[model samples]
Target: MVSKEKLNRINELSKKSKEEGLNTAEKEEQHELRTEYLKVFRERFKKKLDSIEIVDDETGNNT
Candidate 1:
């Protein structure tokens, strides 16, 4: 059996962790939404590059 204060502390930490987990999940969802928004713009930008000559920066060769 645990002491009353120890048990209370454990309970408090549990609640705190639960709240933190929810906050982290919310942030992750927001990040994913921002990534998807960028993806839409990236696709549009790719169309403009198709006609330009592509070069590989790593090897200094045409890709």
Candidate 2:
């Protein structure tokens, strides 16, 4: 999971972007944070999908 601080920074950067704009450094930081956030989210989602069990009631078999 991404840390609270990074998440907070991501929000802050977004607000700043809409309100005024971000400098190059801030934009880079925001991009990095977003990428990290997505990576973590996708990994967790994949894990959940992998854990799912599908069963056929008629055959009493698990796939």
TM-score of each: 0.38, 0.86
User: lDDT tens digits, residues 1-63, model 2?
Assistant: 999999999999999999999999999999999999999999999999999999999997996
For residue 11, give model 2's deviation from the true position in Å. Answer: 0.8
Each model's number of backbone clashes?
Answer: 0, 0
For residue 35, model 2's alpha carbon misses the true position, in angstroms, by 0.9
lDDT of each residue in 1-63, candidate 1, tens digit only: 334664455455456567764366655654554465567668768876776788899988987
The top-ranked prediction according to TM-score is: 2
Candidate 1 structure, TM-score to reference? 0.38
Point to the candidate with the largest lDDT.
2
In model 2, which runs have C-alpha deviations exceeding 4 angstroms?
A: none
